[model samples]
Structure formats: structure tokens, C-alpha cells
Target: MDAPGRARREARIATFVGLASLASAMGIGRFAFTPLFPLMQDSAGITLAQASWIASANYLGYLVGAVASYVAAVKAPLAARWGLVVVAASTLLTAFADTVARWVVLRLVAGAASAFVLIGASAWALALLARSQRLRWSGWVFAGVGVGICLAGLTALVVASVGASARWAWVGLGVLAAAVAALGWRAFATMDAAVRPARPRGLGALDAASWTLILCYGIFGFGYILPATFIPAVARAIVADPRVFAWAWPLFGFAAAVSTIAVSHLARHAKPGAAAGCSFIVMALGVFLPAVGTGLGTLCLSAICVGGSFMVATMACLQQAQRVAGDASGGLIAAMTAAFALGQAVGPLTVTAAAPLREAIARPSAVAAALLLVAGIALLWCEGRTARK
Candidate 1:
């Protein structure tokens, strides 16, 4: 092959590595439990409150890992390698966890590992693709998260049909993650040359508008997590059959993947903040659907709306940070990430508190939708602030 052909081939490999890495880390390590939680509840008689604690533990660990990744000088490939290993180990170990305490610890470890894997693998893959001028392939890399989610949800649907225990489902996911890690292990080798980022020009570029965007990003996290964490459970309440309710998550994941591609086109016509604000409005509608409407149709529509819009908000928020903060965007972006993680941690706890209510999902969904609507309006104001300045 010619030199150019060789670079393109290497870039393609990098894309696959990134996709598989994120699938294992995010889809399995971070979100597999969401799909499997109902099974765990059935098998172990775990209460919704206990599940909330477990989910919050994972989110808290993700916050810690995000901060560590930002401050540390670790090499990309090394972070990617060990992160994936830990994610697989933590997931597999959860199979033997007999108590809520062990579940919390294992999930915490898995969450932190997922964060590191995301940062490291994304950095490594994007760098390689940029070098080869195949950066467009990066979209497929991120879509892996949704693909993995769909895959996990489908796997759970299958496992439930076969009457396999939740432990067996965990074992299956752990093995699958390990398999992908091993397959893509060599692709990260070429990324060893990547270096730590340079010192920033400081937070001088951050203005009121930037801070508002950060807050809005956090709100987006809180709004989406309610559905992302418990949509399966909610669907089950309406439809006891796994074959029927299990499809909710797969639809959510599919919409997530499609939205990623859709957002790029959206950017061509509107500012990132404007586009993201519209996403929040759509997500607010999604969040409210299940609250007011009944049956599988409304629940599934909610899943599609919430899942489809969160990534748009995420991508747009970071892009807006870069635009508004210029050379100082790194720290600003990190702040937004931490804020988002904190919001996610708070979400399930809110659910746990509402678990005692006569109508848990509707009340919380109402509150979440209200918050989202307020934030959506705030983002539009922030967008205009930039224009006025």
C-alpha cells in the first residue's frame, strides 16, 4: 500500500478501536446495570431505594474519575488499556456480589473506569483520525455508546426469555467486554505518542454566558437520567412482559445513535446553543409524556425523545464552551462535565425519595420536565448574550 493508503487503513482501525472501547466502557460498564436492574430486583428482592444508592455510587465515581483525568498526565494508551481492564473486572466481579455494599463498590469502580476509558480512548482515536484526515469516522466511534446500549438491552431481553439469572447476564457482559478489549488492544499501540495537554491560558475567556451554558448542561443531565435509569422499570409497571417492555431501551439506544448524526446537520443551520436549547425543549416534551399519557406508546415515545436529545445537548454544550471560552475552554469544559455528573448522581436519589409516593414516576417526571423547560429558555438567553456581546 502507498503511504496515504496505509494511513487511511490505520485510521479505520482506530475508528473500530474507539467504537469498541466506548461500547464496552459506556454501554456495558456504565449502563448495562440499567437494563439488568429489573432482573436483579426480581432475583434478589432489591428495593428501588437500594438500587438508587447503587446508581448514585457509580455516578459519584464517574465525577471523581473525570476530575482525575483532567488533572493527571497519564498517557492515552495506558489510560485506555487499564481503564478497559478495570471496567471488565469490576463488571465480572459484580456477578458474585451478594450484598448491596458489594454492588455499590463494584459499580463505583466500573463507573470510574468508564470515565477514564472514554477520555483516553476518544483522545487516542480522534488524534489518529485527525492525522490521517479521516476525522469524519469519529462519529461512528461515538455512536458505539448507543450501539452498545442497544446490544445490552437486547441481550437482557434474550436472557430474560431464557430464564437466566441476572448473575448470568453480568457474566455474559463481562466476557463480551473482555473480548472487545482484547480485539482492539493493538489499535491503541499507535497512540502511545500522544502527549498531555499544555497549560491553559486560564479561565479569562469564560463569561456569564459560558457559566449559564454549564448550568444548562447540568440540568440536561438531571432531566435525562430519570428516564435513562428507570424507563425499563416504568415500562414494566405498565407491561409485565419482558418481550414488550424490554423494547423500550433498545428504542432509546437506537434513537441516541441516530441523533448523533442528526445533530451535525442541525449545526449547519443554527448556533450550537440555539440547537441545543431546542433539544432541551424536545426532551422536556419527552420527559412529560409519560407523566400525562399512559400505556407503552407514550413510554416508548418518551424514550425516543429523551435518548435522542441528550447527546445533542452534550455535543452542543461542549462546542459552545469552546467557542465562548476560546483558549481557556479546557477548564470550562471540565467544569461542565463535573456539573453534569453531579446532576446524574442526584437524579436517582430523587427517584428513591419519590419511591414512597403514591405515584413516583409521574411526579418526578413532572419536576424534571419543568426544570428542563426553564433550562431550555435559559440557554436561549445565553445564546443571545453572546450575540449582544
Candidate 2:
């Protein structure tokens, strides 16, 4: 109720709201295409590989955007506020593009814009926190991805319920994203700013441990994304509820947010690698649940597992990299981000390869479950050994 306490509380709320809004716009909104891919492909008469390209194009743009923003020294605090506007506008434009080529270009632009918005907002959030509180605040801020994912999923359901066409869904998402952007703009505009300028640096500055961390992160990327990309489709296959398609993503997002917050606490007491390994174990269990259970509850549980582990491991890896690499945060962040994008790029192909097995196993969840379990085992081996040393 006091002045300083009230001020601090307000500041924290601003950061949380700003970060969450950015996540909804950039992290969740832009990436919704992955979950929506099957539906879009079916409606648009595109191939799976082509659908994959749409997703890839977005990430490719993200890489370019992140790099470009770093190089331009574009006043991140200022950029963060506006990036959401641009991203939202771009999301809306994606609705107008009719051809695949046009969609690709639009998505690419959207991706780049999203990167600027998210990275800028995140950097600002971290900078605002005291040094002692930075890591925990950053972890909480990162939970925006989960929140965004939930929003996107909820939107998808609403759009689907109206029996809207795929094109309409795209338009709806764009408009919704823009609306969220406006709210974000308002939230960050009047609040005190916290970001300071830092010049972009190259990855060569990263040490051996940093490189190891990046590689481990890449594995996490490859392992976790398969479920993220395919789980909705897998859910569609098992549960007959047309509504399941809409509900699946929100469920995933909700689970992801909860898991990120819960495991972040765990990260304080445990080795980061150990925490990551345990996360993967959970992911493996969640991804496979439906194949064995084939019920709606299984679908919800699977979402919980994948969503929770999705970013917890990512944050832990980044934190570990910062600790081990020291002052090489820029390079380590870049490497980890790049590896994650690459893992996501390869995820669909991995799922596609298991197509024949889907028929035999009677579920795609089975394949995803096996993949995550193997990934967890690898993470456990790495972490367990690292812990022993």
C-alpha cells in the first residue's frame, strides 16, 4: 500500500503484461501455423512438405530478423513497443495473400517482425529486473510463449466453431494479433523503461561449455518440437470431437505456461541440466500417453507435458550457458536460438518419416512418445554425467 511498494508492484505488472502480450503476438501467434498446418493444408490443397516450408519460412525470417535487429542497433526499447504493431499488421496482411508464394513472403516478414518484438521485449524485461532478480523474472517473462500459445489455440477453436474457412482463420488470427498489439503498446508506453543498449557480438566468443550447451539445446529443440508440431493433428486423429481441434492448442499453451513457472522454481535447487533432463522425461511420457490411452484426458495430459517442458528446458539451457560462458550471453543466445530453429525445421520431417509406423502402431502419438523418450534418455545421460563431474 506504500508508495515504493505500489510503484514496484505496478512495474512488475507492466513487465509481465508487456512480455505476455509480446509472447502472444510473436511467440504464439506467429507459430500457430504449425498446429493449424494440417487443417490449412487440407483446405488449401497443399502437400505436407509445402506446409513444412510455410513454417520454415517463418523461422528463416526470424533468424534474419534477429540478426538484422542486432546489427542495426535499432534502439530496442523503442523497437519493442512498435514491433508488436508491425507484427500485428503483418499478421493481418497474411490473410490477404492468396498464393503459397505470397503467404511465404508474408509469413517471412511476420517472423522477422515477431523476433524483433519478442527479443526486444524480453531484453527490456530482463534489463528492468535487479541483477539478483533478473533470471527469475526472465523465466517468468518467457512464460509468455505458453500464454500466447493458449490464446492462439483458443482463437483457433472460436474460428473453427464458426465453420470458418482456413483463409478466414488466418485473417481472424491476424486481426486478433493486432488487437493484442494495441494493448501491449498501451501497457509499455506509460510505464518506466528499463532497457539499455548492447552491441551485437559474434558466436566465436563462446567457450567449449557454451558450444556443448548449444548442442544440448539443439537436441532439446529437436526432441520437444516434434510433439509441439504434431500433437494437435495426433489429437484430431484419436478424439472424434471436432471441438478437439480448437481445444488442443489452448490446452498445450496452458500446460506450457504452468510447467515453465513450476520447473523454474525447481531450477533454483537442481542443476540446470538435471532439470532439463527431468523435463524431457516428462515430455516423453506426455507425448506417448494418447497412443496408449486414446481418450480426451490423455490428449490434455500430453499437452500439459509438452507445453510445460517446451520452454523450461530452453530457459535452463540459456541460464546454464550464461553461467558457464560468462559475458558471452549474446553469442550463446544466438547459438541456442539458431539450434532451436533448426530443430523445429527438422521436426516435421522426423514425423513424416514415421508415417508407415503410424498405421502399424495405430497412433502417431506412439512415434512422438518414442522420440521424446529417446531424447530424454540422451539428456539424462548428458546431465547425469555432467552432475557427477
Candidate 3:
């Protein structure tokens, strides 16, 4: 192959490696707890609050890991590899813990480890790829999270179907994560040894506007995740056919894949603001349709729209943060990621909290969907202002 062809080929190969490993580390393991929540609650005999804390632990760990990994990447990409291995180990440990308390701790450890691996791999990719190609390539790399989500979701579907055998699902995910970690280690080693410039710490680029975006993104995180996590359960509650619930997640996975591609394409023409606005619009429609409409058809449509739009929104938010903050984009991205993590962590908990209201008025799922619509509107407004300015 010609030099250009060889470089392109190598970058593509490295990107796939980075994405798959990242999906295992960050996407599947970190978010898997959501779909497993109702199952784990039953199996572990835990209160909603306790289960919520376990979810929170993972997010808190992700926040810590993101910052730590950012620092570690500057010195060596191997830091990411170690982080992935640790997270995978923690995931396996979760399977051994019989008590809610122990599982929470394990999830925290897993979250931190996954964060370090994801942030480090992403930062390394950003630094290594040429500037002209970074945006699109980085989006593709980030798609690993979606890929992992699909895997975890599909696993949850299968495990949930087995009645009481769902514990094995956690073990399966841990093993999958570990395998991905091994693959990531090999890929990181193969890539050119390039070091990142020093990052100014202490929330480097965060400003008032950036903080607003973070809050908005947090809302998006919470809104998107509630549906993503519990759509299967919702399907079970509403659908006549129980098996239809099992299919919700795989559909979500497929939608996520499509959305990743769509968002990347949109980025080529529309600025981040336009992209965010478009995504939020789609998400709003998705959330409302399922809330007001009926049957599996609407449910699947909601999943497809929500899955695609939110993923794109996240990418657009990060892109906007990078554009607005320049050198400080790293910190801005980190903060937004933290916010996003916080939202996902809180989403299921919010559902549990709202459970009591189900008897009094509308269903909890409807309430959650309404909240998502509100968040989408907020995101659209924010993006519009950003574009105008």
C-alpha cells in the first residue's frame, strides 16, 4: 500500500480497536446496571434507594476516572489499558457480592476504572489523529460506547428472559469487558507513542455559559437514560406479548448505531448548534409519542428516535464545548461528561422516586417522558442561542 493508504488503514484499524475496547469498558459495563436494575432489585432484595445509590456510585466513579485518565493520558496510553482491566475486574467482583452494599462498592470501582479507560482512549485518539480528521474520527471512536450499550442491552434482554438466572448476565458482561480490555491493550501498544500536552487542571475551561450547557446536557443525560434503561420494563408493563420487551434493547442498539452515523454526517454541514437542535427535536417527538400513543410500534419508534438523537446530542455538545473553549475544551468536555454521567446515574433513581405518584395520577413512565421533553426543549433553546451568538 502507498504511504497514505497505509496510514489511513492503520488509523482505521486503531480506531476500531479503541472503540471496541471503550465500548466494553465504558458503554456496556457502566450503563449495564440500568437495564439490570429491576432484576437486581428483586434478586438482591434491596430497596429502591439502595439500588439508586449503587447506580450513583458508578457515576461518581466515572467523574473521578475522567479527570484521572485525562492526567494519565499525557504520560502514557497504557494508563487507559490498566484502567480498563481494573474496571473489568470490578465488574466481575460485582457478581460475587451477594449484598447490595458490596455491589455498590464494586460498581463504584468499576465506574472509576471505566472512566479512566474511556477518557484516556478518547483523548489519545484526539491527540494522535490529525486535526483535520479528528472530529469525524473521534465521533466514530466515541461510538464504541453505543456499541457497548447494544451488547449490554442485548445481554440484559436475554438474561431477563431466563427468569432467575440473570446473575450470570453480570458475569458475562464482566468477562466481555475483560476481553475488550485485553484487545485495547494490544491496540494502544501498536499505536505510535505520542504524548499529550499538559492540561491545566481545576475545571480548566468551565465558565458560566459552559456550566449552563453542562446543566442542559445533564438534563439530556437524565432524560435520555430513563427511557434507555427502563424501556424494556415499560414494554413489559404495556405490551400484551412479554417477548416484545426483550426486543426493545436490541432495537435501541440498532437505533444507536444509526444515530451515530447520522450525527456524524450532519456534523459535516450543520454546525453543532444546528445538530443539537435537530437532535433535540427528534428526541422530544420520541419521548412524547410513547407517552401519548399505544402499542409496540410506538414504543420501538420512541426507542429508535431517542437512541439516535441523544447520542448525537452528546457528541454535538462536546463539539460545541471544544469550539467555544479552545485550549480549555478538554476541561469543558470533561465537565459535560461528568454532567452526563450524573444524569444517567440519577435517572433510574428518579423513576423509583416517582413510583409513588403512579397510583395517584399518570404512570411513572409518562412522568419521566414529560421530563425528557422538557429537557429536550431546554437543549434546543440553548443550542439556538449558541448558534445566534
Candidate 4:
């Protein structure tokens, strides 16, 4: 084979491995909690209050993981591998843990691992792809998150159908993470991050537009998370059949995966902020839809709209950060990550505080939708400002 052909082949492998890494980390490791909520409730008789606390533990761990990755310098490859291992162990361990406290501890570990794998695998694979000039395949790499979520959702559905325990779901996903991590474990053991460390910058140094961008990202997190956690439950409320309600999460994952790939191809023409703006608007609609319609069709559409747009929103926001901040993009992105985590962390807690949400999902979802809409406008306004400059 010619050198060009060989390089392409190698790029393909890197992309596949990268996809596997993210699938294990983000999809299965980080997000398996959402899909498993109902199963746990069924088998464990877990309450909403307890579930909220447990879910928040993972988000808190995510925040800690992000901070740990930055405070300490670790090789990307090794971090990715160990992160995968921890995710598998935590997930596998969750199956046998007797108390909710134990589950929270395991989830916290999984949460931190999710961040490590995300940072490590992304840094390693994207750098390799850039060198190979196959950066377009990055979309396929990220689609792994959606793929992982889809698999978890489907697994839960299968488990529910067979009258199996939630433990089986966790075990299957844990094994899946282990298998994927082992698949592409060796390639990144030597690869460093894309380059030398970025210059240290802080929030105080960011300009007003950049500040606005960060806040918008946080709001995006706050806005979308409520639905991400509850879409299945909402569906369950609408329908008694496990088969019908269970489709919500898988549909969510499918939309995320497909839309991510589609938007990547559209990157040639669309500005990142502009793309992010559109996604937010669509997501806002999805977030608010079920509130008004009260039907399964509306719920399914909500899944597609929110799921389809979230990754696009993430990709666009990061791209916009890079465009606006340049070398300082690292710091800005970190701040954005923190804000996003905080936003998500606060999302579940709102359930605990809001008396209305228990009686009517409409009020809180409406609030979330409004936030998303406002944030979407903010992103567009910032993009327009940047374009004019």
C-alpha cells in the first residue's frame, strides 16, 4: 500500500479506538445511571429523593475529576486506560453494593473516571487524527458517547423485558466497558496531549463576550440536564408498558449519534456559535414539548430534539471557545466545563426544592426551556458580534 493509503488506514484505527474509549467513558461509564434509574427503582424501590442525591454524587465527582486532571499532570494514554478500568470496576461493583451509600461511592468513582477518559482519549486521538489529516472523523469518535448510551438503554430494555434484575444491567455494561477499553488500549500509551501546555489564564482575564459564552454554556447545562435525567420517567408516566417507555433513552442516544455526524459534515459552512445557537433552540423546544402535549409522540419528539442537539451544542461551544480564545481556549474551556458541571449538578437538586415539579413537571421544564432559549440567543448575539469584528 502507498504511504497515503497506510496513513488513512491508521487514522481509521485511531478513530475506532477513540470511539471505543469514549463509548466506555462517556456513554456507558458516565451516563448509564440515567437509563438504569427506572430499573433500580423497580428492583430497589429507590425514591426520587434518593435518586437525585445519587445522581448528584456523580456530577460532583465529575467536577472533582476535571479539577484533578488539571491540578496534576498525567500522561493521556495511561489516564485513559486507568479511567476505563475504574469505570468498569465501579459499574461492576455497583451491582453487588447493598446500600444506596455504596452505590453513591461507586458512582463518584465512575464519575471521576469518566472525566479522565474523556480528557485522555480525546487528547490522544484528536492529535493523531490531526497529524493524519483525518480530523473529519472526529465526529465518528464523539458519536461513541451516543453509541454507549444507546447500548445501555437497549440493555436496560432487554433486562426489563426478561424480568431480570438491575444488577444484570450494570454487569453487562461494566463488561462492555472493559471489553472496549481493552480493544484499543495500547495505541495511546505513548501519545501526549496535542501540544505543550496552554498558557495559564483565568476567568478574570476573559473579555465580556467570552464571559457571556461561558455563562451560556453553563445555562445550556442547567437547561438540558433536567430532561436528560427524567425523559424515561416522564414516558413511564405517560405509558404503563415498559417496552414503550423504555424507548426514550435509546431514542435519545440515536438522535445524539446521528446528529453529531450530520453536524460535523455541515461544519464547513456553519459557524460554531451559530450551530450551537440552533441546537439550543431545538433543544429548548424539545424540553418544553412534553409539558404542553402530554402524549407519547411528544415525549419521543422531545427525546430526538434534545438528544440530537446536545452534542452539537457541546461541539459548537468548544469550537467557538477555540475561535475566540485561541491559546487561552484551554482555560476558557476548563471554566466552561466547570460551569457545565455545576449547572448539571444543580439540575437534579431543583427537583428536591421545587414543590411544583412533583405535582406538575410543567413548571420546572418551562423554566429550563426558557433558560435554553435565552442562552441560545446569547450565543447568537455573541457570534454576530465576533463576525462583525
Candidate 5:
């Protein structure tokens, strides 16, 4: 192959590696618990409150990991390698966790690993692709999260059909994650050498627009997570049969994957803030659907809307931040990620605090909807202002 052909091949490899890393980190490590929550409650005698806490613990760890990515001097490749390993280990070990406390600790560790992998792998892959002038394929990297989600959801569906315990499901996910990590390990071998360390910056260094972006990202976190975390459980509550309800999460994942690619194409012409605002509006509608309409159709629509927009909104916001912040995008990205993590951590607690779990769903949904609307308005206003300037 010629030099250009080799560079393209390397770029494609990096994108695939980034995708697999995210699938292992976010899909298996961070979100596998969402689908399994109901199973743990049914088979393991775990309470809703305990499950909420477990989820919160994982989000908290995500926040810590986001912070650590900025402050720590760890190399991105090293972090991605270790993070993937830890995610596989933590996911595998969850099968052996007999108690809620054990699951919480394991989830916390998994969350941190996920954050490390996401931030590290994304940076490494994007840098490689940009250097190779293959930046257009960056969307393929983010699609991995949705693909992973789809795989996990499908695995859960199969496990549920087989009448296997959630333990077996976790084991299956762990094995799959390990395989992904091993395959992606070679892609990161030269990443650490290729990328230079980012210079540190103060919190106040970001301009007004960046701060607004961070706040909007936090709201995005709070807005989408309520549905993202509970959709499977909500579906289970509506339909007792696992086979029937299992489609919700995989549908959600499919929508997410498709939307990310679509939105990436749209973003070339449309303003990122406007695109993100539209996504937030759609997601808000999705979050409000289950509250008002309890039917299967409504649930499916809700899944499509929320899942479709969350990753797209994330890509838009991160891309916008990078464009605006230029060379100093690292600190801004970490700050936005930390804010997002904080929002995610708070979402589950709000649901748990509301009594009579079924009734409680509406309140959080309403709040999420309201937050998303506000965020959408804010982004639109920002876009308009930018246009006028």
C-alpha cells in the first residue's frame, strides 16, 4: 500500500479501536448495570434505593475520573489500556458480588475506568485521525457507545430468555469487554508517543461561551440520564415478559448509533449549538413521554428520542468546545465532563427520593424535561448571538 493508503488504514484502525474501547468502557462498564438493575432486584433482593445508590456511586466515580484526567499526569494510552482492563475486571467481578455494598464499590470502580477510557481513547483517536486528515470519520468512534449499548441490551435479552441469572449476564459482558480491550490494545501502542501533554489552565481562564457550554453540558447530563438509566426498568414495570420489554434498550441503542452518524453529517452545515438545542428539545419530549403515556408505543418512542439525541448532543457540545477553545480544549472538555458526571450522579438520587417509585418517575421526568427546554433555549440564544456578531 502507498503512504496515503497506510495513513487511511491507520486512521480506520484508530477509529475502530476508539469505538471498541468506548463500548467496553461506557456500554459494558457504565451502563450494563442499568439493564441488570431490575434483575438484581428480582433475583438478588436488592432494593430500588440500593440500586439508585449503586448508580450514583458509579456516576460519582465518573466525576472523579474526569477530574483525574485533567490533574493527573497519566499518559492517555496507559490510561486507556488500564481503564479497559479495569472495566473488564470490574464487570466480571460484579457476578460474584453477593451484596449491594459490593456491587456499589465495584460499580464505582467501573465508572472511573469508563471515564478514563472515554476521555483517553477519544483524545488519542481524534488526534490520530486529525493528523491523518481523516477527521470526517470521527463520528464512527462515538458510534461505539451505542453499538456497545445494543450489544449489552441484546445480551441481557438473550440471558433473560434463557432464564439465566444476572450473574451470568455480567460474566458474558466481562468476557466480551476483555476481548474488545485486547483487540484495541495495539492501536494505542503509538498514541502516547504521538500526542503531547496539554498545558494546565485555571478554571477562570475559560471565556463566557465556554462556561455556558459547560453549564449546558451539565443540564444535558441531568436531562437525559433520568430516562437513560431507568428505561429498561420502566419497560419491565409495564410489561412483565422480559422478551417483550427487552427490545426497549436495544432500540434505544440503535437509535443512538444511527443518530450520531446522521448528526455528524448535519453538523457540517448546521450550527453545533442549534443542532444540540434541537436534540435537547427532542430528548425533553422523550423524557416526558413515559410520564404521560404508559403504553408500549409511547415507551418505544421515548427510547428512540432519548437514545438518539444524547450521544449526538454530546458530540456537538464536545466538537463545539474544541472548536471554540482551540488549543486549550483539554481543560474545557474535562470541566464539561465533570459537570456532566455531577448531573448524572444527581439524577438517580432525585428519583429514589420521591416515594412510591412509579409515581416518582413523573417528577424526575418533568424536571428533566424542564431542564432540557431551558438548555435548548440557552443554546439557541447563544447561537443567535453568535450569528449576530
Candidate 6:
């Protein structure tokens, strides 16, 4: 093959590796618990309060990991490898934990590992793609999260049908994560040596555009997480049959994956901020659906809207950050990610504190919708300011 062909091939391989790694890290490590929460409650007698705490613990760890990524000074590939391994181990260990405390600790560890995996893998993959002049592949790379979510949701559904416990479901997801990590291991083997480390930049280095991206990204986190975390539970509450409700999460994942790729293509011609702002508006509508329309159709539509737009919004914001920050995008990315993690950490806790378990669902959904609308307006304002400048 010619040089150009070889580069394209390599870029394709790297994109696939990034996708698999993301699936393992974000899909299985971070979100597998969401689908399994109801199962744990059904089989192990776990309470909503306990589940909310576990989710919060994971989000807290994600925040810590995102913050650490800015100053940790590790090579991206090395960090990714370590992150994948730890995520796999933590996921497997969760299956053996007998207490809620143990589960929380394991989830926290998983959350931290997932953050490292996402940040490291993204850095490594995007750098490689850019070097090969295949930067357009990034949307597909980001879509890996949705693919992973779909896989996990389907796996949980299958396991539940067999009357397996949540522990078995965790084990199954851990095995899948391990397999994906092993497949992507070679892609990162030379990444550290090939690329120089990024220089550290503080928050003070950010310009107006970067700050706007960060704040909006944080709001996106808070807005999408309530539905992302609770969609399965909400569906289950409406439909007693696991068979019927189990489809919600997979549908959510499918919408997420597809929407990201579509938005990615659109982003080539459109301004990233405008694309993101529109996505937020649509996502806000999705979040509001369940509050006003309680039927199964509304629930599924809500899942579609929220899942489809969240990752697209993420892709657009990150791309916008790269455009505005250029070489100093590393610190900006970390800061934005940390802000997002903080928002996620607050979502479930807000619900836990605000209402009784049975009545908690609608309030959080409403809050998420409101936050998303605010984020949309903020993004639009930033875009207008940039245009005027």
C-alpha cells in the first residue's frame, strides 16, 4: 500500500481501538451500574438511597480523576493502559462485594479509572488521527461510549431474563471490558514514545470562549445525567415486566451513538457552539417529556432525545475547545471534564435530598430540563459575543 493508504489504515485502526477502550471505560466501568441498579434492588433488597449514594460516589471519583488529569503528568497511552486495567479490576471486584460500603468504594475506583481512560484515550486517539490527517474520524471515536452503553444494556437484559443475580451481570461486564482492553492494548504501545507531553496550563489561561465551553459543558452534565442514570428505573416503575422496560436503555444507547455521528458530520460546516446549543434545546425537551407525559411512548421518546443529544453536545463542546484553545487544549479539556463530573455528582444527590423515593423522579427531571435550557441560552450568548467580536 502507498503511504497515504497506510496512514488511513492506521487511523482506522486507532479509531476502532479508541472506540473499544471507551466502551469498556465509560459504558461498562461507569454506566453498567445504572442498568443493574434495579436488579440489585430486586434481588439483593438494596434501597434507592443506597443506590443514589453509590452513583454519587462514582461521580465524585470521576471529578477527582478529571482534576488529577491536568497535573498528573503521565503519558496519555500509559495512563490509558493503567486506567483500562484498573477499570476492569474494579468492575470484577464489584461482583464480590457483599456490603453497600464495599460497592461504593469499588464504584469510586471504577469512576476514577474511567475518567483516566476517557481523557487518555481521547488525547492519544485524536493526536494520532490528526497526525494522519484523519481528524474527521473523531465523531466515530466518541460514539464508542454509546455503543458500549448499548452493549451493557443488552447484556443486563439477557442476564436478567436468565434469572441471574446482579453479581453475575457485573462479572459479565468486567469480562467484556477486559476483552476490549486487551484488543486495544497494541494501539497504545508506542503512543507515549511518539508524542511529547502536554504543558500544564491553569484555569487563568482560559479565554472567554473556553470559559463558556466549560460552563456549558458542566451544565450539560447536570442536565443529562438524571435521565441517563434513572431511565431504566423509571421505565421499570411504569412497566412491571423487565422484558418490556429493558428495551429503554438499549434504545437510549442506539440513539446516542447514531446522533453523535450525524452531528459530527454536520459540525464540519456548522459552528460547533451553534450545533451544541441546538442539541441542548432538544435534550431539554427530552428531559421534560417524562415530567408531563407519563406514558410508555413518552418515556421512550425521552430516552431517545436525551441519549441522542448528550454525546453530540459533548463532541461539539470538545471540538470547540480545541478550536479556541489550540495547543493549550489539554488543561482546558481537563477543566471542562472536571466541571462536567461535578455536575454529574450533584444530580443524583439533589434528588436524594429533595424528595421521597417514590416522588423524587419528576423533580430531578424538571431541574435537568431547566439546566439544559439555561445552558442552551448561554451557548447562544457566547456565540453571539464571538460573532460581534
Residue lDDT tens for model 5, 94-184: 9998988899999999999998888778877877887798777777888889999999999989988888889999999999999988987
Residue-wise lDDT of candidate 1 within 21-119, one digit each (tens)? 988988888888888888887888878888889988998877776666666645667778888999989989999999999999999999888877876
Clashing pairs in 6: none
Q: Candidate 6 residues 319-381, lDDT tens each?
A: 787678765666677788899999999888877635544368687788889989999988977
* lDDT of each residue in 127-164, candidate 3, tens digit only: 55543254577667767777887888778777766775
Task: Please list the C-alpha lDDT of all candidates, in the order they appear.
Answer: 0.79, 0.65, 0.68, 0.80, 0.85, 0.84
Ranking by TM-score: 5, 6, 4, 1, 3, 2
**RMSD value for candidate 6:** 1.7
Q: Tens digits of per-residue lDDT for model 4 on 1-389?
A: 99899778778887888888888887877788888888888899877888888888887777777667655655567768888988888999998987999988989889889877776676667667767888777788888888888998999899988889899999999999888877766766644435323334555778986788779888887888877888887777777677888899999999989988888886746898999999999999988886687778888899899999988887778767767776445556656766787788787887753443323566667888999999998888878987898
Residue pairs with colliding backbones in model 2 are 256-307
lDDT per residue (tens digit) for residues 72-174 in model 2: 6655556666777777777777767778898788878887777677556655555455432535666677688887787777766776667666677677777
In model 5, state the lDDT of residue 168. Answer: 90
The TM-score obtained by model 6 is 0.95
Error of 3 at 343 (Å): 3.1
Error of 6 at 105 (Å): 0.4
Candidate 1 RMSD to the correct structure: 2.8
- Candidate 1 structure, TM-score to reference: 0.89
What's the distance in Å from true for residue 309, model 3? 1.5
The positional error of residue 99 in candidate 5, measured at the CA in angstroms, is 0.5
The segments of candidate 3 whose C-alpha lies over 4 angstroms from its true place after superposition are 41-50, 67-79, 131-134, 160-164, 190-209, 239-242, 288-295, 353-389
lDDT of 4: 0.80
As a whole number from 0 to 100, the lDDT of residue 117 in candidate 3 is 66
In terms of lDDT, model 3 sits at 0.68
The total of clashing pairs for model 4 equals 0
State the local distance difference test value for candidate 1.
0.79
